[model samples]
Target: MSRIGRAGFKKQVMFVLTISSFIGALIIGGAVYFFETHQVKKNAAYLIQNTTRQAAVMLNDRLNLVFTQYNKMTDKTSLWRLVNQTYQEEDSPQKYKDILECYRDMKEIYSANSEIMDSLYFATSDGTSIPLYKDMIFEKRKINLEDMFQKNYEENYGYYWLNKHEDQVFPTRKPRYVVSLIQCFKNTKGEAAGYMVLNFKSSYIEKLLEKAQISENGYMMLLSDDGFLGGTHVEEKYRLSEKTIREILHKENENMEKEGFSIYQVPLEINGWILVSVVPVGDLVSSSRQFLVILGITILIILLIAGIFSLVSASMITRPIEKLTERVIEFQTNQNVSFPVDKNMGYEMRILAEGLSKLKERVEELLRQVKEEQEEKSKLELLIVQEQIKPHFLYNTLSSIKQLISMEENQKAEDMCEALSRFYRLGLSDGRDFITIQEEAEHVENYLLIQRYRYAANFDYSINIADDILKVKLLKLSLQPLVENAIYHGIKKKEEFGTIVISGYEENDFIYLKVFDDGIGMSEEELKELQTAVGRGKVREESNHFGLRNVNHRLKLYFGEEAKLVFESTYGMYTQVTMVLPKTKGEKEC
Candidate 1:
């Protein structure tokens, strides 16, 4: 009876082990498949999006070059003279001479950029066309200049980009499509003198799209609101219908997936044209499919080996697991309890024990880190308060108020008192670390206003900040310290009166607040030492530059490591101090 009980117990253990191993394998393999597929799609989208944007930039650059040359030609006095002169009147010799001069100038420009230009010409108001290189055999079908001008011209000034159309002015045996840029020139009286036409070959745009291709099956096409302009490496079946083109143009999202293809669109700055890139989804995830297959085969083999090992090792694994459980319970009560590394146990059991031992040490280290962080927080708060209210600044402001009152300037004194009160109120910010940029600007304005009275004609200040960035949130009192530094260290030492300019603007996910002064600046050695100190972000007790270091550290602590202070100066010439911080909208309290 006892022998029979032992055999039944071993069978039960083997059954449980096999079931657990199968479930774990399924969970792990499914997770990996999901993650790998997601990662592949994200990477493909990034590549195609960047590819389309770069292609748009290249096309815009080429078109801008053509526009520049056209502007130069229009600015020429000879071209204007040719357009204003009329051959109907007498003096045929002078009319011919003016035409020849304008044609020669146009020919020079065309020769320089012949690779992109199909033809360059001018159409005058007197119903005459002057071509740089006239066709030897003129086709009977002449392009209607009046109809073309009326249809393409939007305003009476600037250039207009017309849709691609068949070439009619230039004679060719084969059918050729070209995009035209037309500009209406005005005479001295602001009257429409004539229109200048510059034709650009469509093939040049297609070549640019070809260079921006991202994959073997990927292609790019340029589309306007009306229709498609040009495409490169496009298959016949992938040609978009009129309805589909409208849908793509009106879509709210710039990047999307349709059918089995990933599509990315970028708007051209030169003209209102969309550059679209199409890539196959299958191509992007082909490697992921292969990875799934390998993962499945590996999991199956692992389960098979686990099944065989379970029958022999089930009893061995159960004993150590039971022992480890008791130790875990003990650790919960007393974290000092150590997990024993038993040599007699299996390899997995030994590894688990070693891991737990390391975990205990990590927990102790984390506690120490938390304590240090608390101390640092307290120190930062104290520094902020100290920088906000300086004893010398308060004393000088009061003395200025006293002088203004004694001179019977009660109104001026009252204004000074009011500015000081508002300054302190903003500095407190109701105990909040972050405030809107507008509030910070107002605070610094108050500080500078009071200083103007104290320094009198020694310095003057101006604040020029963009309205769009005024509502963005930033650390409270961020600008005051920089302004203080500029006045004390920069402008005070100069011989002549100095000017301090404060400017703020947002660009590319960053906020730049600059304080500039034309005064005695630091030499290279002094500037280098100051930069090093700012980088360390440690406040020196004995130094007069602690305000800068304090602000730098506080910015990093609240915002991130990327927030910093940058300094630029030339000895005895000028100084510029900039506070760079991330552009954030939400108000984060301390």
Candidate 2:
């Protein structure tokens, strides 16, 4: 036989094939594992962002229909006189009887939307009024009538469709938390005759939001510059924080991932209100679980097969070796069939290959454990940052009250003292930053109320929240700075009655908090400049432009990039600021 075609060369080729096959299998298996894992996460992110945005837009359209219906009623009425001209005397028996018929007409329109309107009523400047009720009987129910306008009226006057009187110059004629609308009626001579009110059940917004969710189990909210209008659901103790609202409202429509949730937002067509959706990170993890298990099994099988092949190849490469003069072991093959193994051809080479395979397994395992630790670390760091509250707020508040007392303003000082007490009591975070969002809201509310007392009538503020998200937990003072800016910078400088609204609710897996002001909103130039500063992560100390550098830093530091501050404003119109945070429950710190 020719030396080039020797049987020894065939054995060498076989050995080389076996070793290469094993290596190839491992490379293929690992590549597939990592690529699949990344694809799963990518798909999960896409699902949430796409689904939430669609849901928001759909809900906004449906709610706009409801607003349109009420708007049509107003438009139709505005074209005609309020009191029918058939009756000659404005207050004669016939005229009063006709007026009842006229209000009944409005009631009929209200009844058309029984699903949305709890009751319908009309009130005039001089106190002549009408009401439609489900039971037509006055019943007293204990309610924290604290948020009368946002809960009942529009701030409501802030929305060009309604007007506010001093201390709600009108009576509470309907149930709590209804959409309150006030419209005026003029006579043929263009003289003011009277006004009408439409009390829409708050459910009108909630039901639509509930129905339009991409997932059967996700959080959603309806919010405006006046604050949280309503929500469909809330995660346990996961109240949205004001910082979160600033984040979302900073942009018109946003999809973001923060903490343990995927955040989505869409604007409401009627009120510049935003519909925000939150989906939990856990859900995304679960969505890819089955795929992971299958991929894991496939990878294990490939590794097992590779090991078996390697073992078989090692057992087969048995070409006789020249006897070692020094009695050392050696693998032997002829020159015609030579393949380099760095000159090491002993059985120990097979052992080394086995060790390498095992080493790769250990490396993968260590990587998995490291990944898990990274996730846990993220959660722990969140708790740590939340606890990092600045104590100056309490000190400053106490100082302000002390000054008021020293100035001999006893009644105002007493009120300030009470508000300060409540603020601290709610701020009682047990030296931790975490508290139920409801409590955090109350804390911020107390702060705003105190400011309201000090800024008396300069600007009015309101807090609106949905019931389900009340138990949400958040960091302390996340809201105060935004509201403080709204009062001192935006509203105080405005000529008319400016408003400070704080609202929080849950969306999907995240809690959304919004602080909006119907004050001197930022111009495009100023808004862009401020956003640029925030994007650069700078917090300016000046009160002008409602500096939010400090709040931005805190939110980003704790929540990572997902925690965001959003801003939206039209100079001379209104300013909306939002923040998004995790919907973690409980006040426990790590």
lDDT of each: 0.77, 0.61
Q: Tens digits of per-residue lDDT for model 2 on 1-590?
A: 23433455466657666665656555665666578766776787677667667766765565466567656655553224333343445446755655566566666666666776656555543435565666345553322212222332334432333211211322356535565555555456654455555666566656765665445346677666556654425755344677776777776547776655677776755556677776665555556666668667767776777677667655455432222311122212221222233234444443444554465567669979889767655654453343333366556666777887888878887888888888766655666656666787888877887776665557777899778777766656677767877776678778678878888777877767898998888889988997877776433344243236656766676666777889999988888889887654322332
lDDT of 1 by residue, 279-351 (tens): 7777676645666686777687667767766766666558878988898899888888988887665556677
lDDT of 2: 0.61
- Could you estimate the TM-score for every candidate? 0.47, 0.39
On TM-score, the leading prediction is 1
lDDT for 251 (candidate 1): 79
lDDT of 2 at 361: 62
For candidate 2, the per-residue lDDT at 145 reads 19
Model 1 is weakest, by summed lDDT over 10 consecutive residues, at 132-141
